[model samples]
Every structure is written in structure tokens, then in C-alpha cells.
Target: METAELEPQVLANRLGVEFYLVRQNNTIGCVITIAALEAHFWLESRASDARILKTFRNGYGRICAIAERKWLARPAATRLELTPADFARR
Candidate 1:
């Protein structure tokens, strides 16, 4: 797959979840779990949905980068869930 600039968008779903676009080719469902946010992005466990989105937005750049890398590694995956381990330093 071509390394196109994939812009992330807010997919309307239940609380504690969001999505990122995979360009014109396909839509990649990226799930940033609440546990990941709490562990990696300084998000409170009881943060509201708005707060959750805000935290996700604040770390959007890095999160998207990691998601993109994972997507590249497994191009055929329609959905990818990101965890705190994904953000851990190697």
C-alpha cells in the first residue's frame, strides 16, 4: 500500500473509542482503548467521554503514528486495537 497521508476522523461510536481513516483505499477501524489512554496518555480512569476525546485528541499525532506503523505491518487488517504496550518505549 502507498504511504499516503491518512487523516484521522471521529467515528461516532460508544464511549471510549474512535477511528482513523486509511485514505481512499479502505477504512481502518482504530480502537484506542481506555486502558491504553489511562496508562499512556495520562487519562483518568473515570474521565468523561468528552474528556476521553480530548485526551485522544491531545495525543492524536503520536497515536496516529503508531497506528500507521501497525497498519503497515498488517495491511490486510480492517480493524486494529491499540494498547498501552504499543506506546511503551522499546
Candidate 2:
């Protein structure tokens, strides 16, 4: 899973979300857009596929927390809020 070689859409589909690639100066990173149980938020990473996946596995709580806060700030009626528990079951 060499993320640099895969298309953004492919990675987004695999992760069940939308992704955007951001390039600033000489740096490249990813912003993942996630729709949960009534809310949507983003996660970003400049790491490789393996590292990002590892974070998804081990740091989901932090991700969920970030999403939740973002969701709370801008509540939406059409999206869902997802927790780390939801991701664990996926």
C-alpha cells in the first residue's frame, strides 16, 4: 500500500471517505473528509500509507475526538457523527 503511488480516489474509497491531496511548496499531504452519524470532518496526514494506517489503527480515538469537535462547531443536519467505536466495527 504505497499511498504515493495510489490515486487519491482509490485511497478515499478504501477508507470510505473523500480525500484531497494538498501540495504546498515542496510538501505533499492528504486531507481525508469523513461523514459520520450527522456530521463531517477531516483528518490530515503527511506520513506514508503504512504510517497513516498505523495511526488509524492506534490513534483513532484522537481522530474521532477531532472529528467530534469539528462536528460540534459546525453541526449539520445531513451528516452523521462517528466515533472511534464506529470505525472499530468497520
Candidate 3:
């Protein structure tokens, strides 16, 4: 499935933000930490949820691509977390 085709429902938590990517009728949980956002995407530290969502939206394409690659690597995994290294690799 193409993660870019779907607009994920984003949620904020104590650690960071979480979203889902659908693949073959399955929902794969994905998370990107606030620290990753700040370090890689220029998100402000302690950003508001709205701001965080905006950052995610701004970087949606790249983020989704990475998530897609990860999902393809581990299809059986129900959840995935994006780290600074993931962003840094590209």
C-alpha cells in the first residue's frame, strides 16, 4: 500500500506523535518522536500538538516514504517507530 495515498490520523502522547499507515487492509502503527522532529524537521522543542501535527504534515511525503520502506521490511510487525537515524539515513 502507498502510505502517501492516505491521510493519517495523528495523535499526540507523552513521548511524541503517533499515526497509522494502512497496508493491505492492515493498520500499521507508526510513531515519530518530538526529539526526532526537532533535530531533523526543525520542530520546536515542547511544541504544541497542533504545531507537531503541522510539522508532520509538512514532512509527510518523506516521512511516509520511510514508513513504507520500514513496513515493507517487516510486514508482520504491527507497529513502527521512526527515529532520528531513520531521517538521518536519507
Candidate 4:
């Protein structure tokens, strides 16, 4: 799959699994595969969220590295269809 231009749903399909990145201290670290991407939205803790706390200490740099790598690997995914809420943008 071409990394870029793939939405979360499409990306999951390409990767053959649902994945979500962890954001801690404003840094995105590693990814965790959940029952579904939205699953993490409802759960307080996520599976595979390890390495995020760096032995329960700090993992900011690690998360930023992973996020940068993954995001750069993907293509530009534009907003295909804006919603009513999006129209609020001023």
C-alpha cells in the first residue's frame, strides 16, 4: 500500500490490522493494534501501549520518532468531504 492518501480505515485494511498511535506528553510514540481503531477511543488504556512510558518513566522522544516516521511514510490524505462542523472554520 502506498502509505499516503490512505485514511485510517483504508490504512488498517492495507496493514491487515487495526492500528493506533499513542500520544503522550504531546509526543506520539509507538502504535497499538486494537480490536478496532475506534476501540482505543472508548478505552482508557490500549494494548501494545508499551514502550510508550519507557519503563514507566518517559517515552516522549520515542513516540515522536515513531509518529514522524509513520506520518512521513504516508502520502497526503486530504479532507475529501467536510462536515457541517467543519464549516465552522473561520
Candidate 5:
């Protein structure tokens, strides 16, 4: 897929999540947050790279799985305070 065809915010809206653009060390990436689980997943992709769309798609699937199996397993209150690192250790 082409980068131009992949709009992060559009995907997030389709998934009913929040999307943010982040920059670190001169690199730009997308951070997707699932409000229901308070879970955040980051996907690093260059806007100029055509492969970014594929990367975004894969990351989106991973985040969905993590949110469902890991975050959703906990109580809603616990999920509200959970972080991405918490899922990684599980």
C-alpha cells in the first residue's frame, strides 16, 4: 500500500480509537490508543516510505490483539491505569 493511501487518523476512527503523531530523534511515528483499555501502541514509519502502510496495518492488528487478550482480561479499573509495558511483561 502507498503511504498516501494510509491515513492514520482514518484508520483509528474506523477502529474507534485515538491516533497521535509522535516524533523522537528526528523520526516520526504513529501512536494508537484504545480508550476502553487505556492501551497505547506505537508504530514507527517514515512518511516517505511506501512500506509504511503495511507496517501500520500489521501494528494495528498487533495492538488489537494485545488489547483484547491482555488488557481486556483485566478489570476495567485496572485497565484504566495499565501501560504498554505492562502488557509486554505478560
Candidate 6:
């Protein structure tokens, strides 16, 4: 999918995560999930990282590490996103 056309809320719903907007320089970054487990991964990286490149080289372990160890998947929300101020305090 195109970053310019990224439907974060749709992705959130598909991934079963609470969607939140994160803006910087008036541009939206992502819809990260705050899940304590698994990973919030994206299909492609806008800016590639060497660590991520190495992880992909590791093959299946990459998927396992993300899905099992940390919430590194695309659908995960940010822990800070759903804070009380983001919703009703009561």
C-alpha cells in the first residue's frame, strides 16, 4: 500500500488494535498498537534500517520474534496512545 494512501484506522481494525494518530511536522507517522506482546510490523519500511535488514536475513525467526516476543506488527497501538486523556477520564 502507498504511504500516502495509508488507511491507518482500517489497518487498526484489521489488526484488532486501537488506532491513534501521531503527527510530526504536520504529517502523520503511524497507527501503532500498545500491545504488551507481539510486534507491530509493517509490510514495507519507508526508511530501511540495518537492524531490520539483518532481522529479515534471519528468516522465519523475524516473524516469530515479532509475533511472539514483542508487539512489532503493524496493527499494534502505542502504549501512550490510549492514555486517560485520550478518552473519558471516568
Instruction: Specify the highest-lDDT model's number.
Output: 3
lDDT tens readout by residue for model 3, 1-90: 465634454453546677788767788779887788888899988777788889988998888899999899998897999989888854
Candidate 2 error regions (>4 Å): 1-47, 77-90
Q: What C-alpha lDDT does candidate 2 achieve relative to the native structure? A: 0.40
Q: What's the ranking of the predictions by TM-score, best on top?
A: 3, 1, 2, 5, 4, 6
Candidates in descending lDDT order:
3, 1, 2, 5, 6, 4
Model 4, 1-90: lDDT tens per residue?
344322232223322122234233232223323332223223224323332222222322432344455555642421122122322225
lDDT of each: 0.76, 0.40, 0.80, 0.31, 0.38, 0.31
Query: What TM-score against the true fold does each predicted structure earn?
Result: 0.79, 0.33, 0.81, 0.25, 0.31, 0.20
Q: Between candidates 2 and 4, which one is better according to TM-score?
A: 2
Q: After best superposition, candidate 3 residue 14: deviation in angstroms?
A: 3.1
Which segments of model 1 are wrong by more than 4 Å? 1-15
lDDT, residue 15, candidate 6 = 31
Error of 6 at 6 (Å): 3.3
Report the lDDT tens digits of candidate 2 across residue range 1-90. Answer: 355543333253444332222223222223343333113222344444554555444544555455554455655423433343444433
The pairs that clash in candidate 4 are 4-74, 4-75, 28-63, 29-63
Error of 1 at 74 (Å): 0.3
**Backbone N/Cα/C clashes per model:** 0, 9, 0, 4, 0, 21
Off by over 4 Å in 5: 1-54, 75-90
Q: How accurate is candidate 4 locally (lDDT)?
A: 0.31
Residue 77, candidate 1: C-alpha displacement in angstroms = 0.6
Better structure of 2 and 6 per lDDT: 2
Query: By lDDT, is 4 or 5 better?
Result: 5
After the best TM-score superposition of candidate 3, give how far the Cα of residue 45 lies from its true spot, in angstroms.
0.8
- List candidate 4 stretches off by more than 4 Å: 1-57, 77-90
Full-model lDDT, candidate 5: 0.38
